[model samples]
Target: MNVKAQYRVGGSGLRENWFIGAGFGAQFFYGDHNRQMYFWDRVVPAYELHAGKWFTSGLGLRLALNGLQNHGVTQNGSHGTGEIYDASKWLEKQEFGYMNVHGDVMFDLMNMIEGYDYQRWHVIPYVGLGMMFTWEVPRSNEISANLGIFNTCYINESFDFTIDVRGSMVNDRFDGEQGGRSDEGMLTLAFGLIYKINYTDWNRPRWEAPPRRGPRRADAAKRLTSELRLSEYDALKKYKDDREVVRQEVAVLVPLPSATVQL
Candidate 1:
């Protein structure tokens, strides 16, 4: 008979689901002070470090620290008489550094809809709201929101490669400009790796089973005695049959006993 082992697998334990990751990418600011969207000159360096926990295969939470450099350039038309239609020239440049600390809810779309496969790649989308802190001449804080999609590829048992494209929205002061109808936001495209600290084997159990309790000593002794008694009875019955056969053989070989009694 085969017995199945009871164990857990794949983020089954709460302590095993935690991971840490770090990434580097570029940030693009979109606001009234910028020349245009998708301009290479407006892109700045950005990076992030995060720790996350997966409660299940489909749901997780992450706390991240995101830091980036922001840039904005203002264009004012030249005032020279001959340059009436000469177009705009760079008037002011705003460059500063900022950081965001946020908590996010991450959902694994593929695992939620289909099923969780550890070896396969997965797409996760996340949204979060937090506060943005700027380190400019006049330091300020503003409410912020983040939306992102993460593409993760499993590299090994404990490591994964991830590419994330996310956009962050903050108050217009994020770029030190305030003339826009909408708040300022930045788009970040990053690549990073995640390392799993606590690995869980779904097929193994952490707890130990209690020792088996068998029959009492007196009961065990009685059972053994009963078995031995049965065995001895069978042996005695066989010996009696053997003795009868011998007696019959001796009477057949020496038929004189009956003849002497008759004489």
Candidate 2:
């Protein structure tokens, strides 16, 4: 059972240099393997201490200590008989807990818009991966072969070799026999989100050099100036035409300009 939360330690103006958090969560197992006392009984409340640094826009590396629990279930015979005894009373309970300690390195990639700082955190998402060492108490006490028997030799305490002890040994799932050691060590991957507390400081670079500038005159200004000059050239050409002058004089019954003016 894995319970993840949304309270990630990040902000717009403040990057999380060091973070310590504690949370309560449960793991629920799937399939027919009935091991835990309850479906969600794998109650693992854990704390993590992590450190991170942003190397580029919306991307950072985080190193953390993540710990959790792995709960396993066992079963014994019930008190009920086929046709005589009650059904529920025959059920037995077998529950055990394992400790999972991990040292994990993860990445947090943020979502950013163009021309905007990647640290701006109205809402952010992240994922994680890690390896854990899982340790659990052995259930079967019948055999001492795999578990290693307690012995003292010579002047010390020792067990009788003449007598062979026999009992039902608890076997692990991977092994066919019982009580041969059930603990396992495995790796896991985790994915979740870190809701940013502030948008300004969420892991943006501390101090950035000013952006470089290009040549001063803008393309837009040059285009507009060229268009205006083209319009003046066309107007001067029309003003020098004799037909345009007679049409303008007849339409107004006067010279086109009241005073002499440069075309």
lDDT of 1 by residue, 24-96 (tens): 9888877765654338767888899999887777778999888877766644321112322213543455566
| Model 1 ranges off by over 4 Å | 1-11, 75-90, 201-263
- The local lDDT score (0 to 100) that residue 73 gets in candidate 2 is 35
Judge candidate 1 against the unseen true structure and give its global Cα lDDT, from 0 to 1: 0.73
**RMSD, every candidate, angstroms:** 15.7, 22.7
**Every model's TM-score:** 0.66, 0.34
Clash number by candidate, in order: 2, 21
On TM-score, the leading prediction is: 1
What's the C-alpha lDDT at position 192 in model 2? 26
What's the residue-level lDDT of 174 in candidate 2?
18
